[model samples]
Target: MDAIALLELCNYQIVFPQAQTCCGQPPYNSGEASPAKDVAWHTIQVFSDKKLPVIVPSASCAAMIKHHYPTLFDTGSTEHKQAIELSSRTYELIEFLEPILPYNKQSDSSHTHISLHRSCSALREMEVAEPWLSILRKLDGVEVSLPTLEQECCGFGGTFAIKSPEISAAMTADKCEHLLSPNPQSILSGDCGCLLNISGHIKHSGDKRPCTHIARFIAQRFGIQHD
Candidate 1:
């Protein structure tokens, strides 16, 4: 939902789906598979109204809502049938945005230097970063740079980091290692969980805080256009 707010402003219609929910991550991850299945069934009921594509920012959640729910449902039930419909239209936010908002980076943007971070689950291995880069490249003098170990997890896997503080801290340290580069004028990421955790690590570990999020970054760059 972090990015959804801005997506609306970016010309994407927001579909406030019914029964759409937690993707059952908490219960499913907590060994409550039965409850997770219940959640999935409910999700199917909620979203059956419209066929608009479901755009989720988190890869983990998107994949679950798309791929996991059907298996959890009673296969012969009508609900299971509906689950199939939902999955086909589901997309990670970047996946949906990139193809829809194609723009020439060289002509539309102005910035020259930017460093991008890759989300852990979105490990389409930086493929997702393209949309963000495309957007930033349109800025009035922005340059896209590379983050160190951009593939590393920022250690905020929902509640995983909170539950395992030591391991989470170690992983955050790993994410910080690559992102601590001194030269990039700014840094950006698609995930807020990553931002909060990474920023915390940067502060605690003594790394310069890189700017974050393409929307806010663009909002600043397009101040006149917005006004």
Candidate 2:
């Protein structure tokens, strides 16, 4: 709902379906495979017939529904077939917008600075950095930077962090440490769960930094502007 609202505010036509899960990652990553399967199967059904590409604001979910589904279901199951179809159609929101958003040729020369935090899963799984960076650079009012990290996991491994708060907090601390370099962050853009984790850590650490969903930021920056 927020995504669609922001997309409309930024003038990007949002063609989202009514029914979708919470990405099913929370339970699926846990040993709760049965419920996960039910959720995944539901997703496969909802998205299987989409001829238009599946655009997701969340990278981890897209990666899971795309990359992890086939392994979770039997080969002959309807879920397996649908998973294969959806996987082929799924795309990260940033990856989708970076290519599709109209660039401001004159604006590319303008000035602004921000950092990109390649979320671990999105980095390893979807490789959503370069395209997003390219799109940000194309904005006349913006500059983009690639941030360094100690490791991919920001300790919020879905349920893993829940089962052990200490480990998750440690990971979040390390993540914030790596990300809080002395740089001007107009925004720190990331894929999905990582964004939430990092954003939480930033606030928890008493820092007043801003973060954005890459899609929302890009749409705000360079989607069709209306009067």
Candidate 3:
């Protein structure tokens, strides 16, 4: 909902390709190349338009399409060619919005302090670090802070969390401790996986700080309420 509101604010004619499925990142990250390629082919076929920019909300998914899709096929193959073409047109939501944040309206006068969590994929793979943080700073009353281990992995490396639940849980606990030290009103991240990992830990430990996606945070600043 916030994604829709934010894109609408940007004056983009948003279209959902109902046929679109996964970008095949999960299997690819899990080291299953054959099944990953099959899923990639289906995704490529679904998003067949050569001219449209694929704006992905998740940094991991965007990175998969932009960086790994072409590697799944042989060089100079038709699939590889199409993957390269799609890669060139793909952009993460924050990446797509950085140059065109049009919401200039003032939010409530009350100040908002938020702790930001940038996933390893966003920081390392997608190369998306300050876009969303900078966007929040541009708003009327948002104050953003980074954890001491901001660059550390939240352990939700897609399948990594599933395969190594104990290690993943420890990382999440460590991440949550730092994220809550400042006692911010909310925690924001562009990647849902990180948000989920951190928020779930916080909840189990009886903490209640709101964890939200950056798009939703930005949308609220522009008076766009969730439905």
Q: What 10-residue stretch in candidate 2 is worst by lDDT?
A: 101-110
> Per-residue lDDT of 31-110 in model 3, one digit per residue for the tens?
99999999889888888898788899999899999999999999999999998988999999987887798755545546
Model 2 Cα lDDT, one tens digit per residue, 104-178:
433334465776777766667888767767767767767666656634577777777789989899987876776
Ranking by TM-score: 3, 2, 1
**Superposed model 2: Cα runs more than 4 Å off:** 1-13, 105-110, 223-227
Candidate 3: 10-residue stretch with minimal lDDT: 101-110
Q: Candidate 1 lDDT, tens digit per residue, 32-73?
A: 889988888777777775548777776667767877877776
lDDT for each candidate structure: 0.68, 0.70, 0.85
Residue 63 displacement (Å), model 1: 2.0
Best by TM-score: 3
lDDT of 1: 0.68
Per-residue error at 202 for model 1, in Å? 2.0
Model 3: pairs clashing at backbone N, Cα or C within 3 Å = none
